[model samples]
Target: RRRGGGGGVETAADFARTAPRAGYLHKLGTNVRQYKRRFFVLRPSTHLYYFLGPNDAEPRGCIELDGGGVSAVRELETMPDGRFRFEISLGGDGGEGDAGGMDASFASANDDGGGGRDGGGPRRIVLEARSAECGREWIDSLRSESLPYVRAELESSRSEADELRARCAALEARVEEMRLVERDRDGAV
Candidate 1:
């Protein structure tokens, strides 16, 4: 579950076991467009978390790549200072609102330019990888992990919809029975 303050706690051993990728990456600030080096960890659960450093107990923020949280991931043809860079486009709302598990202070601190929360368009986070191979690996892993989470979410939604449909049908049948009883009473009179 996503909390409003920070990411879930994970010990070093547990983080190493659960995280497929954990390293330093330069993240472009949303408000200023300036790149800042951050320690990033990609968990098996399709959550990409970045912390102030590798030893931080909690993440500064989390990007949920499931249930329409992420829209696309692509490499940029132009390189910034010859770094292998890629952009992850977020879907509507981008899961960065009140429920995205991003610390309020962190968001406000980085978003001093006042453009971060305008909700104007899909939010994109650009990341610079250390090498071309690493960039490709990150892209592939993100794509692969995201699909299973999205599929699971879809399946859950379908099951809920089916249950709702069955309930609606039952209610309609009861209403019809009530109408028939009323009609019989009126005819008897």
Candidate 2:
């Protein structure tokens, strides 16, 4: 029978298989538009962790990798119009929100075609990858690692919504009952 997640029995263990699901996706800053080779790791349920190097135990910074925050990870086929080096962008996924429609899922780092498809979400982050291969690996790893958390967050959101609906229904019933009592008192007076 299914456990925690109904029918399928998806669990935390499923998301937390092993550490360092993949290597770093490299790093880039748009302000200066520079590249930095930093090692990265993801906890799937929590953070997209980056360390100064692979050997470092602590993270440099953790990007919120959940659905409520970052959206999708895609490596641009080629550099966006102007600039040097390849890039991988995270967020929105161009409103596709699905495997078929998303360009990031298909495009290769060095191939060449449009930039990222992140729509206009403020959270979107684009970073430089040294080569096409590096961008591909980062996209694959980020896409795979982030999906489970998104599903879980969606499931949680749905449950909360249902509960809120129930509460609203109960409040409505109570308000109607009070109104009826008020009418009865008016009539008696």
Quick one: best lDDT, which candidate? Answer: 1
- Whole-structure CA lDDT of model 1: 0.68
Off by over 4 Å in 2: 1-17, 79-121, 147-189
C-alpha positional error of residue 65 in candidate 2 after TM-score superposition, expressed in Å: 1.4
Runs off by more than 4 Å, candidate 1:
1-14, 78-81, 97-119, 148-189
**What TM-score should be assigned to candidate 1?**
0.60
Q: Write the per-residue lDDT of candidate 2 for residues 68-90, one digit (tens) a residue.
A: 44555554555564322433344
lDDT of 1 by residue, 1-189 (tens): 232345666433345445777788778776576878877777665577676776665556667677677888899743655579887878765443222444565443333121133367667778888877788888888886786655787899999999999999999999999999999999999
- The TM-score measured for candidate 2 stands at 0.44
Query: Top TM-score: which candidate number?
Result: 1
